[model samples]
Structures are given as structure tokens and as C-alpha cells.
Target: MPALAVFTATAATGTMRPTIATAVAIVLAATSGIAVLWSTRVGAGVGPDRAALGVLAVACAMGAVASGVQAARIHTLAAHPLTELTGGRTGVQLLVTGFDRPIRSGGVMVPVRVEVTGSGTSARAAQLDVVLLARDGWRGLPPGTRVETSVAVLEPRSAGDPPALRALTAPRVTGLPGWTGRAPAAVRERLRQVSGRALKGEAVGLLPSFVLGDEGRIASETREEFRAAGLSHLAAVSGANTTYVVGAVLLAAAAVRVGRRGRIVVAGLALAGFVAVVGPEPAVLRAAGTGAIGLAALGAHRTGRPLAALAAVVLLIALLDPTTATGAGFVLSVSATAALVLVARPVAQRIRRPWMPGPVADALAVCIVAHVATLPVLVASGLGSGPWALPANIAVAPAVPLVTVLGTSAAALGPVWESGAVVLAAACSPALWWLDTVAGVVAGLPGSPAVTPG
Candidate 1:
């Protein structure tokens, strides 16, 4: 991820305006394109090994130049149009840059984070990121929608939130999400409705969040319990979610007698659909990439190197949006996945005994290694977990998959099979009850509060 590091640093420190940045990017691209062509032609004349090495070197150089140009685009916040407003309030138009996370509701007013397209009609669309405290009207709107309003720029309210920009007045919807966004939005809403109708109390709130990442309805108390228990990641759409969905899709495809190549295509489409339904959080994005690699491995009937896949995911994401690297969730997701890929199996193998079976050893390794993998990050960020966190996660681990699969199946059956959906959702009551019991028990334990720095 050296390229990622370079790109992020450059973007964070870039000072060029949009015009200059764009011009530079075009120049870099043209130069790289020419060099790449020249390398291909000249290298063909040399021995095979030398030719391959030459091509690889040219590719790396091109990547570095492209990274610099992208950094220039990311650092657009430093331009005069945005810098001038950083000191005070101003009216501007903003575009929703991502649809990954849901808009957070703080009572009547919601905090909707949208990227800055421009501060005014005359301002260029450099796309500086900011969060807006907007009205109820902003809720349920899909990403890619545009709103115009006045805003007061201020320091970020919290680590997870970006720089706060309070709306002086309610934002007016100037544009709607395109047709491509409508289906995902609709699917999410339908699933939420299905969950509400099929489940009760804790299950109602937990199911959608667990299956779809829609945590809006979760009670504050329940959230605290999950947090203290370190089971919050269960609601973050982990790889387990994708595994269940993809696994089911593959099974169905197989039953229908689809060939290997066709199954891959079907699984890819299904994975995309699942991401849309869950919405795009950093965690969800990570899960999707990992799931894709898992599917590829399955297709080849070979145990591909997972560590390499993880690195590829990191690199691809850096190219797509290096800004994702800044999120705490991203760090935790990548680190934990890497730990599982690299450390979990060995630990499990060492711990395994005749009395302790493979499944138990694997589960123990996952719970322990996940916490260890994320420990440094959490500590450095002044985040912590209770003494009960690890035990609680381990205790609740088995129940998670049960809740996930049933919850997912219920949501999938919602529109077409309402009664069946309700029945399946009702089936989750036992697991939900167990999860709640474990979380409450763990949270109430002495020394369960996350440790804070001295």
C-alpha cells in the first residue's frame, strides 16, 4: 500500500486549484500513456524475463504519477473558493458524493454528509467533503441527489463525522438521485418495512441493521450494550454477511445447473445487489471486495492466497478513493481481515487438541485475533473496549450467523412472500434473545467500561 500512502499524503498536502490540478493530471496521463506504449514495443525485442520486468517498472511509474494527480484532486479543499468560506458561513450547492452510510438522525434535524460541489454558482466543483445538519426533508434521499443551502463551517463534531457545516436554513432539493439509485433505495425501504412488520422490539431494530446496515431504528440503550460487549461489528455488515448471501446464491445457481463461468457472473451480480441493499459503508465495501475474491477462489477450486487478495482490495480502494483510508472503520476492517488471513489459522492450529475440535479452535482464534488486530488502532485513537468485550463476542459468535442468515432470508422473502418472511423473522427471536441476554450480562459486569487513557 505504498502507493496508497503516497497518494493520501499528497492529497492531504496538495495546494493546487482545480484548473491547475486537472491540467497536471491530463499531462501526467498523456506522459504515462506514451511511456507505456514505448515500453511495450521496445521490451518485446528483449528476452522474456527482461521484457516482463520492464513492463512492470513502467506500470509502477505510471501508477505513481496517477496517484499524484489524484492527490491534487482530493486536496481541492485548499482552493480559494473553499478556503475563503472556511473562516465563516456561506450559501452553496452540495452533491451527495457517496451512499455508503445512512444519514444520522439527531431528533428532528438530521446530519447528512454530502461532498461540496461548489460554494456558490461561480465556485468550481472541487468536491470538498463536509457534513450538513439538515432538516427532515433531507432524510431518505439517495446519494447523487443535490441540495442548495447556506452553511456554517466548523470543526468536526466527532471523529467519525467530517467537518461540521450547519445549515442556516432547510436545504432545497435541486436534483434527485439518478434512475440507477432508485432501486437500491427502494429495496432498503422495503426491507425495513418487512423487518418492522415481522419482528418485535429488539429484533425489529437489530434485524435491519444486522442484515442491511440500517441502524437508524436501534434504541440508544441497545446500542450501548452492543458497544460495551464489542458486538457492534456484528451490525457493521462484516464478511459473514457476504459469505451467507454469496453462498446461498451459489447454491441456487448450482441447483439450477449453471456452469462455473455463469455462476461467477451470477454471484458477482448478487454481490452488487447485496451491497446496494446494505448501503455503502467502508466495512460493506471491504466485505464486497473480499467476497469477490472468495468467489474467484471458489470458481478456480483452488485456495488462493487471501493475504494477496486483501492487499489487492486495499490497493483498488486506494485508487477508487484514498479518502476511505482515513476512516477508523477502514483501518479496523483491513487490519482484522489481514490478521485472520495471516494469523488466525496458525493460532488455531497451535491451540487445537484432541479434546478441542477444529471449529472451536477456529472460533477462538477469530475472536481473540480480531481484538488483538484492532487493539493498537483503538488505543492510539483513544478508543477502548470492556474486559467483557472478548468473552461477550466469543459467547455470541455462533448466534450471529444464525441471526444473519435468517434475517437475510426474511428480508429477501419480504416482497414476494410476506407470510414466509414473517415466519422466518419470527424464527430469529431466539437468537436475538440470546444476543440481548449476553450483551446485557456483559455490559453489567464490573470493569466492563472501555478503558480510557490515563
Candidate 2:
């Protein structure tokens, strides 16, 4: 709906700030107002489209208000009592809630969240978020690990970022992740080792990232190359990854002559397992939700109106979690999906000629339109998108699908059959090589990372 887009824009632009009750009142008032206007419009020039837009606009406003409330709540939470003490050390027991992949700055920086359990002098418990900066020893800790330590509470780096605390000494590990978290961690580790062995050189580092969304082993140079070329999103798993996974499952089910309902059931289960393994990152979560909506449309035998389905999903998610309206990634995702739905097919048909096959035309059209669609969001977010993005994507486009299919197969087979996993990984080496070459060449071009201000 036009209102959905307008309200989403309003939210993204950071204009509205209503309380929870005010948001509710607005929704009710808007709904009644639209109904009255639509009914009384029989003698006027007002149309159904305009009425529908009014309804959708109210829905979006409601979402924006809710998101503001959520943001305020989070900010208040970050003002924890532990964070108020500046330059003070306190003995606290922490139960690890989440762990970010460690990165090396001046020293190794490990970002994590923990629930502080008071010990020794204090007995209060509170949830705290901080980044641990050290040269080593942080890599061993996983989610659910308990570590006892003393730390100096400091101010947050910026207004939006999480609060900061410094750990001077290595925390004593008291607990490790139980089976819930251990399974995914173990699987990721084995897949990394297997990918390294099967693919040589850069492919070893890049393949796992393409498949499993793990870029820890990739070289800094290569990682920068990807960012410059605007291909970094491919390395981070997203909706496309989920779609390919579910599509593969559906195809296999079809080959076995499975019933429609049975195929849907199998695909749903596969999608859930994939998300769990991938660790529920924001992009992954959004992709999973979009994929689930698509699957539901298929099960209902109403797959023709994918544009409508995508809109519904976007509106619903925005209403439930309003902050998504302001995220560049989420905006890019919606824009990209919209381009595929509306522009890809027509562009494909126009470009299809005697020399090009239909599928090839479609693929090229998708790459071009997706880049074009997300340009505005990129410019707004200051992520340095440029002309290089289109060509780089076109150059390596064909290799991506192959890498995803084969890499996923390798990951699934690794725990069950090491030999099979290696074979699948070896099959993906050529695609990975091509991808690496494209990134290298494109990233080196002058004016590659053009940063246009919004």
C-alpha cells in the first residue's frame, strides 16, 4: 500500500515519537476515520485506493511509535547500575548470554553480553553488555559460558552503541555451552577445517564464508576487497541463501514424488534447522521470516502474487518490530526484493534475444535491477556503494548459486561423511576461485568505492 511505504519512510526518517498508549489511540482513531471517509465517499471524488492508503498509513504510524518505545526501553536498560560506576573495579560473576566473533584491533576484541551475578561483597544481579579487549584467550569462551572477573565500568562509545566495560585480567572460565549451543559451534568448526583442507589458497578462506557465513579465516586484504566491490553481503548469509536452501529441498522432494503438503513440511523443517545453525543474526532472521512467508504462500497455492506477499511481510514485521524501519540492511533487503518482483522479469524479457537464453537474461536483469534498487538506501547509509557494484555482481553471479548449493551440501555432509563433504567442497573450488578473481580485479579499479553523501 502507498501508506505502508509512506509510513515506513516516515519511521526511517526518524520523525515520530509517540508513547505506547498514544500509538494505540492513533490506530483506533485512524481505523474509524478511514471507515467513515470510505463510506461517505460515495457522493465524493475519493476512491478506494485512497481509502486503503489511509488505513495503511495509520498502520505504519503505529509501527513507528512502537519502534520508538522499544528504542527508549533499550536505552534505559543500557543505563544499568553497574555501568554508572566510572573507573571502579567490582567483583562480579557473569553468565554469558552471547558472543561475537573475536576481531583483532590493537589487541583482540571480543564483544559479548552477560548477566552479572553479584559475588563477594555485592549480591545483586543485572544484565550487562560490553566488549572485552585482550591479545588472547577470549576465543575459547562460547555462549552460555560463565566467567568470574573484575572490571572497570566505562561510558558507551557512542549514543547508539552498547555500553562499554574493560576487563583487565582474563576471566576464569566456570562453564561452557551445553548441548544447545555446542552443536552449532562444533559443526561450524568442523566445516571450517574441512573447507580449508578441500580448497586451497583464498578459496579455503572464502568458501566457508560463502556457505556458512563464517569469515573469521579470511584475510584482511580479501575482506576489504569484498567490501570495496559491494560483495560483502554475499559473504554474510541473507534471504537469498535461505531461498536457495529451501528451493533445493523442494526440488529433491519433487524428484521423489512427494505430495505438496509433505514437501512444504520438509522445506519448513529444513529452513528452521538452517536458521538455528546460522545463529539468528539480524539479516538471517529477516531472511528466514521472509522465506517462511513465501513458503506459506506456496502451501496455500497462491504463489502468483509474490509482490503482495512481500509487502504483507514487510508491513507486519515493521508493525511488530518498528526499529527495522530504520535499519539500512532491512531497507536494502526490501528494496532488492521489490526490484526482483517488479523490474527483473520485464528487463529479462526486453533483453532476451537470439544470442541469450531466457535464464541468462533473467540472471543478468536480476543483478542489474537489484543493484539499481538498493542504490538509494546505500547512499543514505553512507556504505560507499558505487558503479563497481553492478559489474562485480554480474561477473561472479553465475558462480554464487553453484557455491551455495555445493557448500551447503558440504556442511551437511561433514558430520555424517567426511569423505563426501570433502568431495562436495572440492567441487565448489572452481566457483570460489572465480569469485575470488572477480573481487580482486573489481576492487582494484579506480573510483571503486565511491562514497556519495546523502
Candidate 3:
């Protein structure tokens, strides 16, 4: 039963390679069941509970068989030639499978599953991943798009090495000879329209990336600054952005006298819209999963435990992509969410003064939560464990929601009303400037502690 629980939980989380782990789990379960059956048949005291145990043993055997079958399927899927493409080999075409945006990483990474047909041989691959560094003129090719590129295919080299870096040494292509073509016209048009309205001069190039995860125009220097300052999450399609957008939509609904149910409906729509806009990367999807769970809790009038929700989401995500079990972003995202849920409340309560306003308290809570959660990783990554992170976050937290909502709205409106977009962008400038300043100041502090052993 214990083995079964672990297997089931791991599978549901989508974080593990189902075939290998599930197979091992099933084998262990089968062995245990056989041992239990043999003991019951031999002359062990077979009481009523013992009989129940026998029945459970039989159930476990059946479950093992089922898991074995599933494992076989996963093995077959993993064995496909196309999916196996790794190791910096050249000359292949693949279909863009998936992507992610980690806060600590400077750019988006894309994973492709290729169907290679060469020398009259055809093969299919599943989720052959790659990293697409955000470049000045780079645009994302949508999923199912067949891009024919001469990429170096590589394989997973070591446990300690980063997956993105490993992927670069060996790469594969999907949909070659027949480029899968660009993203849908509607999506492109919407992006262009949004970009045109929300951006001007220096900011114009960053609009696509900010709005849709298309990081073609953002300058390299700006990207570096964001990473060095620990503010790179702002550029990613993370839960922070999603939550802010959803919250804004809910607030607007409330202002117009929308009831609870109505507000939920609006929130759901906005969440969906945000996902669409951001292109459904894995990290964003995880964030969305947690956000949805949070909304459900709100709707039920229950105390929404963000940590529990994050755990549930992590479990699910891990089951789906077991490889991500090793990804730093996965660890960081879960930690950040846990921090917000578990630590923020207590910290805020402790620090709340009689003179503190409701808004200030809320802002402080947000900072405390995110800062506490991310501290271990920040330190471990050699980015410095500045005790001042909390204060800096507190100072910046208040403006995050403002920047997300107004900036997104401005970008969306930029194409429709350039003038309105300009106004909204102007309104957002102060917050962006302040955020940049805080990051710069905190990052510059001397003798910050490193979480990892030097």
C-alpha cells in the first residue's frame, strides 16, 4: 500500500519518467504482495484483519499489473527515435513541443519533438527539448510549427549539470523540409496590435516579450540587469503576473457590483486570457494550476493554503515531467509559493504596527512571503543572501500589482489606442523605475551571504 501510494502520487504529479519509476514501483509492489500471500497461506494467524490484509494483497497485485502495463506504454513512447534525439548532432527537423520561463533564467527555453525522415527512414520523437536564448530579433515559433533548422542535438550528460545547457551540446530538429509554419494569424495579429499600442521608442521592442513571451526586442543589457538584480521574474510568465491580472479583473468586477459568482467567472476568463497571451509554458502552467486551486478555495469560502496547493501542483507537474524533478525553477517556484502561504502571514502579523495601514500590511506580507520562500535558493545559487531582501521586497511589492495590471492593460491597448497606451505606460513608469532601483540597490550590497558552500 505504501509503495502504491508513492507510485500513484508520483504519476499524478507528472514529474517523473513514468515508465522507469512506475516499473520499479510495480515490481516492488508485486514482490510485497507475493510475500504477504505466502505468509497468509503458511500458518500465520489469519484473523479477520488478516483476511482483509489478504484481500488488500490481491488488490495490490492487480494494481501492480495495471502499473506494469502503463509503464510498458511509457517505455514505448520514450523509445521513439525522434524523442531520443539529443547530443549536439546536426541536420534534423522537429515540431516545437513545449517551453518554459524561469525567473532566474534570462530567456525562454523551447522543447521540440521531432519526426525525422532521412534516407527514406522515418522516426518520431517526443519532447526533444532545446533552449532558445532571447535575442534582439528573435521570435518564438508556435507549437506544432515545423521548423527546419541545423541544430546540434545533445543528450542528458550529468545530474549536476543544468538541463538547458546540456540540451545545447546535443540538439534535434522537428518538422524539417516542411516548416510547420508560423503561429496562427489571429495570435500574431493580436500580438502586433498589442505591441504597437503599448510600446514606443525604447519600450516598443520589449512589448512583444512583455505581453506574449516573445523576447525579440528586449536589449541584452536590460536582461542582464534584471538577472543581476534578482528581478528577472518580472519578465517571465509566472504566477505573479497571472495572479495580478486575475486580481485586477476581480477588483474591476467588484467595483461594478459583480457578485461572488460573477467575480469568479470574470477571474476565470481573465486567467484563461493570460495563459493564452503567455503561450502556456510549463512554469506558467504550474502557476496557473496553483492559481486555479486558490480560486477554488476562495469560491468555497475555505482558507486557501497556498503551500498545500503548491505541493499538489508540484506533485502533479512532477508526475507529468519527472525530468523537471531536477530543474531549479521547479524548486524555486514551489518554494516561493510555500513561502507566500506559510511564512507571510506570521511575519506580517509580527511586524504589523498600530500605525500601519491595511495596504502597507498587505504589501509587507507579500514581500515577507516571497522573500522568505526564495531565500534558500537565492543563497544556494551564490546570488548573495542579503538580509535586506525582505525590506527591499516590501518596498517593491506594493508596485508589482500596479505594474502588472497597468502594463498589461497598456500593452493590450497599445494597438487599439496608442495614446491611451502611452498614458498607461507613463503611469507605470514610476513603478518600473522604483522596482529597478530597489533591485539595483539590494544587489549592490557588499558581503552578502551565499546559500551554497563556496
Highest TM-score scorer: 2
How would you encode candidate 2's per-residue C-alpha lDDT over 216-295 as one tens digit per residue? Answer: 67787787778788898888676667766787788799999999889979998889878766655455678886655544
**Model 2, which residues run further than 4 Å from truth?**
1-57, 60-68, 71-75, 82-99, 102-111, 117-124, 128-135, 149-161, 164-167, 255-257, 280-283, 291-325, 450-454
lDDT string, candidate 1, 1-454, tens digits: 3444434433433444445545655554565566566565664456445555455555545455545645455454444354556647777777654443333244333334444535545555544565566554556666667778877777644422235676777668888877555655665677777777777888778887788776767776787777777777777777657766786788789999999889879888888877766656455778777656544433343334766686667666656655555456666776777676666777877989999987678667766887888878776765667777778877987777678777877776776778888888888888888998898888888988742211
Candidate 3 per-residue lDDT, tens place, 1-454, comes to 3333433534432323655547665675877577587656655555446656666665466445445544544564456453345443434455665433322244445565544522235433344444543322123445655655444444444421222322222232334322222322234345555455554543554444444555445556555454555565566556567767887788789999999889878888888766654555566676676656544433333345644565556654544555463365656666665555555556666788999986578557766677667777767865544556566666778877787787667655654666776677667656666766676666666643322211
Q: What are the Cα lDDT values of the candidates?
A: 0.66, 0.68, 0.55
Model 2: weakest 10-residue lDDT segment is 12-21
The deviation in Å at residue 280 for candidate 1 is 5.3
User: Which RMSD does model 2 reach against the true structure?
Assistant: 4.9
Q: Give the TM-score of candidate 1.
A: 0.75
Of 2 and 3, the candidate ahead on TM-score is 2
Positional deviation of residue 344's Cα in model 3 after best superposition, in angstroms: 3.6
Model 2 has an lDDT value of 0.68
